[model samples]
Target: LMVLGLIGAVVLASGSLIKAISMIILGLLLGQINTDVISGTPRYSFDIPELTDGIGFVVIAMGVFGFGEIIANLGMPAEHREVFTKKVKGLWPTKEDFKEAWPAVLRGTGIGSLLGVLPGGGALLASFAAYTLEKKVAKDPSKFGRGAIQGVAGPESANNAGAQTSFIPMLTLGIPPNAVMALMVGAMTIKGIQPGPQVMSSNPTLFWGLIASMWVGNLMLVILNLPLIGIWIKLLTVPYRFLFPAIVVFCCIGTYTLNNSSFDVYMTALFAVIGYVFYKLKCEPAPLLLGFILGPMMEENLRRALLLSRGDWSTFATRPLSAGLLIAAAIMIITVILPGISGKREAAFQEAD
Candidate 1:
């Protein structure tokens, strides 16, 4: 009991510290610095003036990072001897593939829609959970990871569904689901809008209109993706030589536009380089991203909870829910590294072989 208490305390402290640091670093990277506090500090220098409010982070993250990935993906030589360079398959799902995937799609959508409403996490978790669920419910249970339709369908639907529905709690309740929500609130504040429980009652049109637009936008996405599927398929058939450079160029331009500073372009390229290294290392970026986003909130909560507890440190364990989560996290950390860690994954791979 004593050892568990100590381990919990250390783990909680470390996680909170990391979260605080990440939030502060991300805020700086995105230009969310409040100058009033820093103006008096002689050592502090405002790097980018345009980052006065910090909304540019999402645009750059999406546009520039996305473009870089597209470019790199295009660079894998066509007809070359590389896993990522394999020839394109039939664009339309084959009958067998469709038969396998249809059920997983339905299941993933149902699970993801609910997970997205939770105020504490992001679509990343929803996607991971979707993948896990698909594997469990699969009739054959061996169709995963080998160009399985369900593998693609479940995560795609979950991520997309989560993207739209995540706005439910954010806009209506004014409680953030993830870092993006926090950034959205920051953006709203810049626009002279206030968020809270009353905002829904006070601004019915703004709230309802946002919700309505999401439905319309989702419909448009389906319509656009349907006709354009063929075009995108044709694009995949094109050789890598022409496509790769274009991707790199677009990413560079998008990154540069964020702060209108060349430094950010360089910074983006640096991260891209790191991304490629990570690709080689087989390190998952999902956790890294989640860690980065959660880093700040964790710190704030730890401090607030502790201060309220008068530094008792027992508050975390004293609260039933928090204690339960902390224990689960400990068990997960232990299980992830044990020999059984890769048992299922290895079995899956052998089946693939």
Candidate 2:
């Protein structure tokens, strides 16, 4: 599934398959840093204690998506770098917009709810999947990546639904599905509330309260943000010269505070340079990020399966579910790589350009 997401990102988001693949490889290499979880041996730590623990996702993400983008924007011509400061009107969607968006929202919500329960599946993956699914199902797929209403509605809905459903595993099974849930688990522990099946019966108030809070929080966001849209838009009017520095400073501070380590700050800076290089190369970082997240999990699961099968390589194909997924992946790969389909895909994506 992760592989499929990465491939889709490369195909849909990044036009250059080779560049995206190279970035994914680079991410996989970076993911190899720190001690091997299975063998307890360091792979790419270079004898540094900080590297031994592996790089934090926050460091990579902030560097790549935040700092890197600032750098990219700074490099662009002044005219090209200007923010969209046009006058706003019609904050509400039209009836036709709702008609088109409702179906997409429903599909996105269903996809997100299902994916969110899986380990390592969260809002990011769900949003990407939903967006890709929308493109796949759209009457004129070329309308995507432009001003398509479905593009915005589907991903936003998916993201919210995925975020809400991600708590299920954490609350019911005492397993944190993602980093946020891990923090929630810690907080619950600190509060003397044990997570798991017993929590619903033993601490019904907390369990039910949390569920109720989700709905209330959603309503609060809608209430607060709708009125504040103009204010949010006004922020874009701020000069890039002032805005960029503040963004960089805050991001550095946030990265430093993540582990209270200067090493992470330095790592973030290093990745920022890498991200800038990626920007110059026109290589989309999203697939790389996905690869980095999924690489370790893939390795761990593969090792576990091998261990269970006593080193039998055929174990993957021997299992019906695993075989089906593998076959599906293979078909997707073939479909994307075929000359006829690849040419049409390129032409379709070219419309966005």
Candidate 3:
């Protein structure tokens, strides 16, 4: 819960720009923050000379690994790519398929538009919820998870639509819709733009231009992804000997761009090693990312809540919403721990269906 709260705080703080770069840099550092499988343990300490709270580790790792990956990709021969680069499939969705997709797209758009206004909204959530809703809303519910066209349409559209709309809050209100947006806010602040409702009033060009660009960007993504999806799929079919280097190069370019420091590249390589190790060990990386990203902010919020309650422990359980959230957390924890116990509840739903 503490880690979750911290993640929430970071999400609320970081608005939706530079999501890619931050994900690369900060993500790597998070891998180093606490190697322990479990968070909130006193086993880890912040006494390391090089790792003063994991941010440096993240930056360094990002630079090295990202650059290394790019270098590796660049090393691949074009002649070798020719062996696998077959002609791609069609660029457009069929008219019948489009008909199947439109409703899901509409619903997803509605959900994303609403979610976009809220701070800390995530594209993944919008996508997942849209997917789940589509599953429920479909006439043939069983067709989903089996390449149903609507399943692909709604969540894909919603997540993209949500991602695009999330910029509105950052542009209009100066409040970040997510961590990426928060970084954008930082960049804007650095550029002497005070974000608020008045942003439109003061700089109609920036506001409107950005809005226009999003639609343009969507068009661009379609043009790019349609041809590239075939390519992406093709890459999977290519020999592993060629693929691993491409992965290394992609990581390197993305990571090195963070601060242009070679140290950051090396740091990224280090994290990649750690990530590989984690994969081998069968430990979950999701929680680690959540913990490292949210740790500092979580501590701040906990202290603030404590202050509000005059250091009373009961405050967490006393507030109506807070108490409800806590109860929900407990339910989630127990459900994950003992899913078998909920077998009857699951069967009841199946029977209801």
Candidate 4:
């Protein structure tokens, strides 16, 4: 938990979502190599039998995101609570607000669509990036944390676009970018459908129908959610003592159902304590969850790439596409290190209001 917590701390400190994600991938790859193929001996196992099977990503996610959220919320003071004001504003945006928001939504949707195609890039990253991008482009950036219209419109559109496009990789390329995609891949298998390029040709109706359904579902969600917005706002005003326990119970039940294992529940409790410590230390858990998911998969792919390249390290730099991606990654890292870059980034988030 502590190791994962450290990863999360680094991710939050880096101030670049993409940079943190890439680092998590690299870290997972590092943790994944368990055996020396030539020597035929366990390499990072430290003689622990459980280490051979590796850590469970589900456990980590439940601990970091599920329990962690509960702990963090518990630590917050009552004065920090946010409540909806009784003041009435029209449901529709003003003309100036619409003018500012429409372009932001379009840009966010485009960014979300493009990034959602990449492995490990999905709705969460897209939402964060979209919000950051909107703030960067806003004339009065100080209005953001203070209920800026662009902040809401941009991220909401980006998240929707990302949620839709994230399926492209799994449906077209047989690659699951995140855990949800992994589940979708399982669903395809259960339906006797191969998830690849042939899926489009062999299951054209299912493919096109799924795409059409996304549009219909999106429309329906808007229609359904608008009326329920007031209900959700009311939920926010519920006392923390009552609300937190309900959240805890739901999480515990969900975790138990994951494998019908009481061990998982116990582990969640342990993680909740760890998460509370993290809250006290002011560390974030998002990166840790990302790392926990990517670690084993990254190790497998890295090993395969090395084997295919005959262990040639230069393979990464020699391949045109790989080289280009590496260069882009390097530039991102350089930007993070340059003076004032980190400061300005933090300032944007700090001055969100």
Error of 1 at 72 (Å): 7.3
The worst-scoring run of ten residues by lDDT in candidate 3 lies at: 9-18
C-alpha RMSD of candidate 4? 5.8
- 2 or 3, which is superior by lDDT? 2
In candidate 2, what are the lDDT values of residues 95-149, reduced to their tens digit? 9999999999998998789667766657777776788678766777667655699
Give candidate 2's whole-model lDDT: 0.81
Shift of residue 38 alpha carbon in model 2, Å: 1.9
> Can you tell me which runs of candidate 2 are displaced by over 4 Å?
7-11, 85-87, 96-104, 128-152, 186-209
TM-score pick, better of 2 and 4 = 2
lDDT by residue (tens digit), candidate 3, 227-280: 767656676567656676676676667666766656556666666665554434
Q: Compare candidates 1 and 2 on lDDT and give the better one.
A: 2
Candidate 1 regions with alpha-carbon error over 4 angstroms: 1-78, 81-95, 103-111, 114-121, 124-148, 176-214, 337-353
**Per-residue lDDT over 85-141 for candidate 4, one digit per residue giving the tens place of the 0 to 100 score:** 354446555799788789988988986786566565467656655775676667677
Give the per-residue lDDT of model 1 (tens digit) for 1-353. 21232232222211122332343344333332323322432222356554344333434344334543554555666565133345665666678877877787887787678667755554654675576566545555555555568878998788777776787787777787877888988887888778877778877887888788878988998888877777776665555667666666776777677567776665566557655554444333333333333443454466667778899998878888788877877884475336664365445434533
Could you tell me every candidate's TM-score relative to the true structure?
Answer: 0.64, 0.86, 0.55, 0.72
RMSD of each: 7.8, 3.1, 9.6, 5.8
Which candidate do you rate higher for lDDT, 3 or 4?
4
* Candidate 3 whole-model C-alpha lDDT, 0 to 1: 0.58
